[model samples]
Target: MKIGVDYVKVRRSERLIDMTQYLLDHPHDLIPLTFFAARYGSAKSSISEDLAIVKKTFKERGTGLLETIPGAAGGVVFTPSITDEEAKEYIESLAERLSEEDRLLPGGYVYLSDMLGQPDLLRKVGRIIAAQYLDKKVDAVMTVATKGVPIAQAVSYYLNAPFVIVRRDSKITEGSTVSVNYVSGSSERIEKMELSKRSLKRGSRVLIVDDFMKGGGTVNGMKSLIEEFEAELVGITVFAESKFKGERAIDDYNSLLFVQDVDTSTKTITVVPGNCFDKE
Candidate 1:
């Protein structure tokens, strides 16, 4: 391995420096301990110790912050203090990056399917949304078909709860499915799905989750599904929210990605914890 005086400066071990750097660059990004241990050719136990040291030293210095979330979706998140100037600079940088020509898909779309698969990114985004609903007693998560499923899954996993899939159409095993009509992003009529009188219990609190909200139609559909179960709408969480002109259907919600671009080839995406500052 390429070693430098800076690398050797870690007062703990060789891995601590690497670990700190990993967390620094990927603030609020949650990752499994095994993955980092494997990446650095260290043991999970060894890495855990190293992380503890790193977390302690960094937190003491106010240069690092670590959060340990328990459960299947739980992991460590390292976040550094971000200044308002830095936030604006990053957002502008993202806008410029997304304005490139090569990134655009057909039909004036910027496909972000690949980014959703990233574990670290998903975890951080999920934590920010889940933070809003902490101690709210949310039962099951609900989301529309296809792309939104992953976002919903991430939130549900972090919340340590099962996510109810709302399909576009009914399947054989669904058994008396609940259907709701809604308008698509392109102004086309569409219907979303939910299992008929399934897992959601009465008066159960629910947090609506989705990947993107163009017009909040799908969000509303999911809200209506929650109503079908006689559940209380705790809050809505989204990975991204378009600031298009219209009233939002849901009141309390969280979003990581806020801006929407009408013309972009690269479809540069900007993300932040929009809900992290809100009152729970």
Candidate 2:
């Protein structure tokens, strides 16, 4: 290949590193081969070869995936995913931490803010959740305000979709809002939730995420909001669920960990793997 006189020739190793970094930074986005070719002052064929190597490495390491498109308008996109073994190990570690007696809070609630606030853990969570919906063509992620926000944001980061937050109180900044009333699953008291009318469009496919669920009243309320917008609820996932609760308001959902038992008197808790690993 003739090196362009106007541009400095870049080494193959440097090119590979740059290309891989670019793809990882812009996951789920398509970039034309011509763009990379021009940026590196190399031929499109060379760029394609580099991408193939990156794809192989990604698959071999169980990091993520690279999808190539053919033809003149084609390029590549990265999709974040986690291997089953790694995901299982991570969940088992999380459950162990959750079982600690010190994490127990008043009213039988478990404090998980420390784990949720960790960026590394949240990124792993994003990868696992995103992997589940890789083929679902999800349009947006929705969650109730506060605890669910981080999980929704993490999942949306990997999914390359925008996230919508439903608030417990109406905000004037949201302009016109749609509100719904449902019984709080944990407290068994009637509660209200609201979402902005402009935040979501009709017929959008949404994935609901939350940090915890007891009775699933909050998720059920979000479901009603989805109905009000004429959008579809693709799926629901929670970081954890309390097993002590009665029948959930929503049956179709996934949890990463289940709080199987908790005893305030003895300050002990038991946790088990959720239904995500159940053999179908």
Candidate 3:
């Protein structure tokens, strides 16, 4: 019966692995202990012990935070986070890559599609942004489409919040929409952006994110839309911000990278870490 006992141990090990995977995948969500106990046919106490081990490992590795709520209805919720040392290193590397000559585009825009598309980079960005507002109760994440979608999604993933997209044009499928007019930061032309009325609830605390910012017109437009929805703008962040001649449309904001200078003719770009690293 030694083999049978070993098999039982193997099954328990498999259950632990599965439980950890489930918790990691469903960050910011409460999973009932009974659900897991029923799913794995294990005792609640055993599941608690397993989660304790998982939580310890997660803390040691700087993977994320696993919060346990005590009560009959309580369970576990994961909050993704990155250690400071890792965040600093990642941001520094990203600044170097962004400064590459070939990444410079026309009109001083940097080509960042590849970086945004990478799952690893997005996760890092999300964790960094989420860490900043960990203490705050952020109700939702908002971004102006189409480039801002990825960054917003990443941040929302870590924050365990839903995201809403603001479009340049209102779509009929969206039902009712609230439109706001603002100056286009790059073009210096008046432009309008809209969001679905049903997307954001009233009095929500929102965090805004975007891929890039210059004069902050698009971000300002989103801010205005948030006001129209009767929501509060908790904070604003961008992937990168350009050092431009004119004053920025908005003053309070954070960014991951600052494009100090970009020479399209020479194909040279200078980048530095953004306000996110600034000491408050």
Candidate 4:
């Protein structure tokens, strides 16, 4: 916590020890550049050099728990042997920042739709959910068309499961297919989707996923469609759920984000975690 040049002045004498400790304390949260810049407020090139040095030190010390995943949403992940004391500290810090009623929208919505695009966050959540169903016979993932794709894709990636898209309408692209009817939040009457009969094999276990839930009509219809295929509904998962959404018919599920609200007039977005992905 003792930052600034004063910390650096004495660093000329015992730099390596202090630097190694800093990396261990903030393993995953800091980007390499951010980590080094905080220590010295130095240039990007210098920070990169320092990261290289720190990484080498970690390897030589036999502490290979810090891993760097390359690419856009990728960074570091700390697989550590830390005590529950440290884990509690990290969880509490996130909870303090993320838990706020102001994040709720007008009516009863929470706006965490963006986390769907953050691969790093979704990957963590997906792994947790997929682990719960690992021994089960999950054959494929199902979801209503549109926004639900990302969650389905994430779970599919982790489970090595294929995803089946239940479209809102029959498209020429689908050719001959089976269709279903269900009410939607967007409408009260009913909506439809066409899934190729070949898309799912009978008696297969289907894992359903969606982005947001209000009424659960779309997902329910998805579940019913699985029944029609004589397939087992292994489980269902969502990115976010509105508390207002009345009794969900299906229970085995997970959610990453919880919508507090979406104040379109003020253009405010409020969200938190109702699911395990961002919880205490």
lDDT (0-100) at residue 229 of candidate 4? 85
Q: Which residue pairs in candidate 2 collide?
A: none
Off by over 4 Å in 3: none
What is the total number of backbone clashes in candidate 4? Answer: 8
| lDDT (tens digit, per residue) of candidate 3 on 1-280 | 9999998788679888998888877888899889889988889988888889889999998888889998988999887777888888888999999998888777767899999999989988999989888778899999988889999999988888999999997778999888999999878999989998889999999999999999898989998998899999999999999886788899999898998998888889999999887855
- The residue pairs that clash in candidate 4, if any, are 103-270, 105-260, 105-261, 109-260, 109-261, 110-259, 110-260, 110-261
Clashing pairs in 3: none
lDDT of 1 by residue, 1-280 (tens): 4466556445346577677777766655678887786787767777777878887887676453587776777679765533334434543444454445565677655566776787865665565556556546667787777888788887776566677778877788878776766666447577655655676778888887887777777888888778778888888877666665666556567665554555544455443434434443
Model 3 scores worst on lDDT over the 10 consecutive residues at: 101-110
Give lDDT per model, in order: 0.67, 0.90, 0.89, 0.64
Runs off by more than 4 Å, candidate 4: 1-113, 185-187, 245-252, 260-272, 275-280
Q: By lDDT, who's the top model here?
A: 2
Order of models, best lDDT first: 2, 3, 1, 4
Please count the clashing residue pairs in each candidate, in the order shown: 2, 0, 0, 8
Better of 1 and 4 by lDDT: 1
Question: Residue 136, candidate 2: how far off, in angstroms?
Answer: 1.1
Ranking, TM-score, top scorer first = 2, 3, 1, 4
| Candidate 2 wrong stretches, greater than 4 Å | 1-10
Off by over 4 Å in 1: 1-101, 188-192, 264-280
The Cα error of candidate 2 at residue 241, in Å, is 0.6
